[model samples]
Target: MSLVKNLLVSISCTTYNHEDYVTDAIESFLMQKTNFDFEILIHDDASTDGTSSIIKEFEEKYPDIIKPIYQTENQHLKGIKASGINVKRAKGKYLAVCEGDDYWTDPYKLQKQVDYMESHPECSLCVHAGYVVSASNKEIQRYSRPNKINKIYTAEEIIEFGGGLFLTNSMLYRTELDRNRPGFFEKAPVGDYPLAINLALQGTVYYMDELMSAYRVGDSGSWTVSSFSTIDNKIKHFDQISIMLNRINQYTNLQYQHVITRTKKRIQFYLLVEQEKFKEALKEEFKFIYSEFGYKDRARMFLQGYFPGILMSLITIKRKLNL
Candidate 1:
C-alpha cells in the first residue's frame, strides 16, 4: 500500500513545454522527506517537446508515488481550463503546487508546511518565500517575506503585493476548499492571486519566512512574460477580477473597491508603459490614490509626474551607477 493512502497531500505539478526543467521539478518532489504521506500528480498539458519523456522516466522509476497524466491532444486553452483539469482530479486533504518550470529547494518543504497547517487550524493557506532564479537555476533575486507574517492582509494588500506573493508554486492550501469551489482557478492571466485572496477571506494566511522554492524566471511560457499589451489580454485580465468581486459582493464593499483601485492602478501603469506617456500615466495612477493608501502613495504618484524627465533619467542613472 502507498504511504500516502491515509494522508492526502497531493503535489499538483503542471507542465507544458518545460522539457528542460520538468525532470528537476518531479525529482524535487520525489526527494521530499516527510513523516506523513504525499503523492505527486504530474499533469503534462500536451507538451510538444521532450517534456513527456522526462515525466515518463520519473513515472517508471517511482510508479507508486508519481502519477503522470499525459494529454494526447494539445489543449490550446489557457488559464483555468488547462490547469484546473489536473487540480480537479487531485485526491488529497491538502494540495501543494509546483509548476514544471519551478522546483522546491528544500526537501522538507512539504513536511514543514503540512506540519504547520496541521497544528494551526486557523491558517487556511500557508506560503513560503522563494528565490527568483534564472532558467539555469542561477539566483537572480531573492523574494523574502516581510517581518510580519501572522497578520491578515486585505484584498488591497494582496493586489499591491501580488508580484511578491509569486505563484502557486510556493503555496499549500486545503484541498476540499479548492475542489468545492471549481471556479477558483477560472480567472484570467492567472488564478493564484485571486484564489489566495478568496482563501484569505475564509481564514488567516500564514507565511513561512523560509526560502523553500526556486522560481525559475526567463521562461517565455509564463503568462506575465507573454504579450499583455493587447486589448484581448487586458480585457481577459480585467474580467477575471471583476467576476471575482461580483461573486463576493456581500462580503465587504470596501474590499471590493480596494481590489478595483489596485487593478485600475496596474492598468494605468501598463498603459503608461505601452503608450510612453509618463505624464498621462501619472495622472491615471493618481486617480486610484485615496485616503486608503494614505499620502505617501499619493505623493509618490505626484512626484512621478512632477519630476522632470531629466531628473528621472538622472535618478535612474544614479541607481544603475550605484549598483
Candidate 2:
C-alpha cells in the first residue's frame, strides 16, 4: 500500500537462491536511464543462499530506489507467489518485470517503453526481444521472435502462443491492468503468460524488436528446471496449464473458445508425444498437430515410435563422435 508520488514505473523482481545472479539483476535496474522516476520492488522468498545478502547490499546503497520485502519463511512452499506480493505492493503507473536471474542490457529500455506507453495510451503492454543466455551468462542465442518486425498482437494470438511467446524480463505493462486481474490468475502455474493474456484482453499489446535484456536459461532453481525435472511434474504442469486455459475460456465468456481449445489440443498433443503414444498421436484429430513440429522432429518421432534400436544407435554414435 506504499505509494510513491509521480513514480512512472515499478520494477517487480522475485528471487530465491539466486546468489550468483542477483547482483546482475539489481545492477541492471540501477543502470536504467530514464526521464521519469522508477522504483525497484524486489521480493526475496527466503532464499537459502546469499541472494538475500546481495539484495540487501543494493538496498542499503540505494534506499530511495530499492524497496524490498525479505521473507523469513519460504512462501512458495506454502503456495504463495512472491510476484503476487510484489504486484500488490507496487506503486507505479507501469510495472516492469525482471527476475533475479535476468538482467536488462539497454540503459534506455525503461525510457523507450515509457515513452511509447505515454504517447500511446491504448497500449496495455509493451515487450521487446532479448538475448537468451546460459546459466553461466554465456550468450546462447536471441529470444525467438514471432514476427520479423515490430507488431501489435491480438488476444487470440496471445492465447494461441501461450506463455513462451515473449521474454519475461522484457515485459512492461500498465499497473492497472494487473491490479484487477481475474481470479484465475492467482492459480495460474505460470505468471507471465496469463498476465500477458490479461493485458491483451484489456487493450493493445505491442512488441518491439529490440534486444534490451538478457534472459537466463538453465538456472538450477528456476521454474522451468523445477517443473520439468520429472515426468510426473511435467504431466502435472501440463494439467495445470490445461485448467488455467479452461478458466480463461470461462473468464472470456467463451469468446476465445476456439483459440483456447486449439491451445489445449496442442498441449495434449505434446503430452501424448512425451508418453510415446504414437498410435494416439497419429490419430486423425492429432495428426494435424504434427504440422506444427519441424520435419526433423517428425522424423525423430517416426524413428522413436517404430525403430527405437536404430534411433538409439544413431544417438550413441552422435554422442561418441561429439556431433
Candidate 3:
C-alpha cells in the first residue's frame, strides 16, 4: 500500500491503446501548480500497444504522485468497469476525471474548479467548455463559441439539451456522492452523460465557460465510431438510448419527460428508416424538433420521408459534391 497523504483531489485517468496521446494527458495533470495536495490514479487496461509502457515510464519517474493500476490481461469493453475499481481505490475528497485519450489545456483548470466547489457547498459537480480536436491534434470544432467563462446551469436545462452538459475531460465531482452509489457507469455504451445526470440529481451543476480541454475526435477507439456503418448499428444506438431513458425514469426529481420525448423521436426515425416508412417517420419527427437547430437539419429530416430512394441518393451526392 502507498503512503496516504492529505490529498484533497484524485484524478482518475483510464487508458487503453492510447499510446499516441497518453503522454500529453499525463503531462497536463503533472503540470498543475496548486497549493493543495493532489495525486493521480492511472489504470492501463492491458493495452496491447505501447500505452502500458508510457504509463510505466511516468510511474517510474513520479512514483509517489502517480499510482498505477496495471492489468496483465485485456479487459476489452470492460474499461469502465476497471475505472470504477480504481475510483474505489482513490483516497480523496474529490475525484476529477480526464481519460488518457483526452487532456486539459489549462494549468489552472484544477485550481479553478476546486476553488468554486469549495465556496459553493451546494454544488456537487463542476464542468467547463472544450474544443474538439482531430486525431492529429488539430482544432476542428469549438464546443461553445463566442463566450469563454463559467456559468451555472440547472438540471432542467441540462435535461432539455439532451443531457450532454459536460464532457468527461472537463468534469469534477465529490467522491462521497459516487461511493454511495456503486455501478454508476454500468448501463450505457459510455459513462460521461450518466455520471453527470446522476450528480445533477443530487446537487447544483456549475458550468465553466472556459475551454479547458481538447477532445480528440475521429478516433476508432471512440464509442461513437461506426463499425459497419449499417442500419443495424443505427437501430442499436436508438435501442441503447431507450434503455438510458428507462433508467432515468426510475429516478424521481428528474425532468425525464423531455429526454423521453427526444429519445422516442430518435427511435422512431431510425425504425422508420429500417422499415422503409420514411414519410411517417418525418411526420413524427416534426413534433419533437427543437427550435435550437438550423433550418437545413429540419429540412433534411423532412425530405428524408418525402423523397424516394433514388431522389434521396441524388440529394446526398449533391450535398457531398457541394462540400
Q: If scored against the real structure, what TM-score would every candidate get?
A: 0.78, 0.87, 0.81
Query: Local distance difference test, per candidate?
Result: 0.66, 0.79, 0.69
Higher-ranked by TM-score: 1 or 3: 3
RMSD of 1: 5.9
lDDT of 1 at 184: 35
Q: Which model, 1 or 3, shows the larger lDDT?
A: 3
- Clash count for each candidate, listed in order shown: 0, 0, 2
Summarize candidate 2's per-residue lDDT along 179-202 as a digit string, tens digits.
867877889887888888999999
Compute the lDDT for candidate 3: 0.69
lDDT of 3 by residue, 237-296 (tens): 657756776667666434577755664665465456556664564463444432222343
Candidate with the larger lDDT of 2 and 3? 2
Error of 2 at 291 (Å): 3.4
Q: Give the Cα error of residue 51 in candidate 1, in Å.
A: 0.8
- Candidate 3 regions exceeding 4 Å error are 1-4, 76-80, 144-149, 160-163, 182-185, 226-230, 253-255, 266-278, 295-323
